[model samples]
Target: MAEGKVDPVHQFTIEPLFGTDHLSLAGYNIAFTNSALWMAITAFVLIVFVGGGAKQALVPGRWQMAVESFTGFVDDLLRANIGASGRAYLPYVFSLFMFILFANMLGLLPLALVGLHPFTPTSHFTVTGVLAIISFSIVLIRGFTKHGFHFFSLFVPHGTPLAMIPIIFPIELISFMVRPFSLGLRLFVAMMAGHVLLEVLSGFVISGTNAGALTFGIAALPSFLLMVGICALELLVAGIQAYVFALLTCVYLNDAENLH
Candidate 1:
């Protein structure tokens, strides 16, 4: 972030790993960025981990079991929320869940202590927003394809009096339209806020240590402990946020699959 002081927001900075001058295509720079690198890292790791784990075993190894456990968890989640048809969407939903899960988990690595910075791509609204858009698009496309114009009924509650149609319709429609923004913003804010806080506490630790033994004991010690606690909490949040995003996705898909 800075010399002798941590810049909490610096972790989220997106910088091109290579000089930006060398590449341009369709009016967009083709330079690879630190953010893109981490995303690629996340994708590569998932491909290896999930791909290797997909092999079924007669006596199921721990690795396979672990993969199955996570998949099955998502499976059950979808079944409960979206019913039998949900199984058809497993490949996509599972991938989305695991991608977010691994990206988040990897970003929390303590590589900064080793002079390497770990970037959490999810902290950026652009990444999360794209994800939200894809999920929302699937819902919209599937709903219209399956139910046609009847899908519009999603914004109209059943049993509402005809007189209330003007009032209730706009409110529900506005609420429905806000889903993608809320979905993306929720994950982006949660991930970014946690990292910022950890960075700030880290700054306190560094500052206190440099001050003197007294400050180190009183200030840095507490900050360090708080950092430790936050790390654990962040691990929990990573999984929860992934699950929440996937869960909400299932919920939205339900509206598409079975209009209500």
Candidate 2:
């Protein structure tokens, strides 16, 4: 039981927060879970961070500055990737960026130390897949709404030889279809991998100390040091993955907003 508690894969479990069994809804099991709890927590944190910063002040405070910094960062990312007119989508892009950033960062909290579960919603493909679908759906809707049937031109490049049309179109269409899966999988895999590594090292620390003082020196100390370094790297990765997801979303938006 003690060993099972420290299992690396255990971190990803989605236990129901309320009832013992999952609820049924049209053949789907929909239970409020730890994952859902963390998502709510993530949303609450984002709301506070953004809402707290929306104060009218003569001289901006640190909290306000931090909010503005993140806002500007997203704005700049959009501008750089999608150009001047891209500011129209700032609300959507900013919300997406901040939510993912906060979710990734919040999941790293050491809540388990205080007897609370800390689940990263983004560590699950379902959450990330939904996010990717939202972004992809926006691109699809905007593409059709703005460009009409010309939106299908997205699958075809600016120019190509007549003979190459058959092959190139199919390949490009296939690649385009894979975007949501790739985007979601990237975040899920990155977040899950880090947590699994941390859990494994933590297990080593526990088991080594329990084995003997000699084994503690051989396994526990080195694993603890590596865990520290890995934690720092994971922090960096959390932010990077968020940025990459947002950046790729912006790139996809460019295909819709600019068609180039």
Candidate 3:
């Protein structure tokens, strides 16, 4: 009999879902990829969650209560940070939160079924980068609309000495420019690292089972334990990153409102 393939790290490969050539336009190649499918799934989940929970009541049922709690939490966060004006941005913030939370959770599922493929868009820089850019644009447009030409003064700071203006101005400009980079990188790195770790540990469990069934059986326990622990951690991260993104949005909105 042929020896079983023992290579590790084969699970993370990004393969096309269908045989069709990926759609190419300009320099960007778009495909009906697993990532795209999962993003759609995430959107569907958000729609269902919100739509199903639309009914309001003084005493709510399970779904209604869950949705109400989330809405209330976001409302409180906005009020505390952005004040009454924050209500205007609630829909955008809510959509962002649910989309991200669903995406991260869906990526944790068994994505290697015969007919279905699962992939994490959050692991891709392009997806995260786009999200960051959208948030950045929101801030920029709000700033420009509210403050007019004076918004550029944000880089100058209030108390800097005249001699340090040249030095400090460029630094502030660079920092502001890099906000999207930092935001995108933070979420991408965290999701990528967590998934990679889970994949490596899973590979060990599978490979060991082929080598020595009994010994591997024992070793598999820890792998399973770690997988569960990682799942919980990922769940926390999913909610947290969503909140961080939304919170930063509110903070930027507040800055625009105050012309700071």
Give the top-scoring candidate (lDDT). 1
- Each model's lDDT comes to 0.92, 0.90, 0.78
lDDT of 2 by residue, 1-260 (tens): 34524778888998997783568799898788989888899899999999999895768899999898898999999999999988998999888888888899999998878888788999999999999999999999999999999988887887888888899999999999999999999999999999999999989898888888998999999999999999999999999999999999999999999887
Predicted structure 2, TM vs. truth = 0.94
How many backbone clashes are present in model 3?
Answer: 0
Ranking 2 against 3 by lDDT, winner: 2
| Top TM-score model | 1
lDDT of 3 by residue, 130-158 (tens): 98889888889988998888988888988
List TM-score per model, in order: 0.95, 0.94, 0.86
For candidate 1, write residues 5-89 as lDDT tens digits. 7778978888888686447799887778888899999999998887778887788788888888998999999999999999988
Candidate 1 residues lying further than 4 Å off, grouped into runs, are 1-3, 20-22
User: In model 3, which regions exceed 4 Å deviation?
Assistant: 1-29, 111-115, 213-221
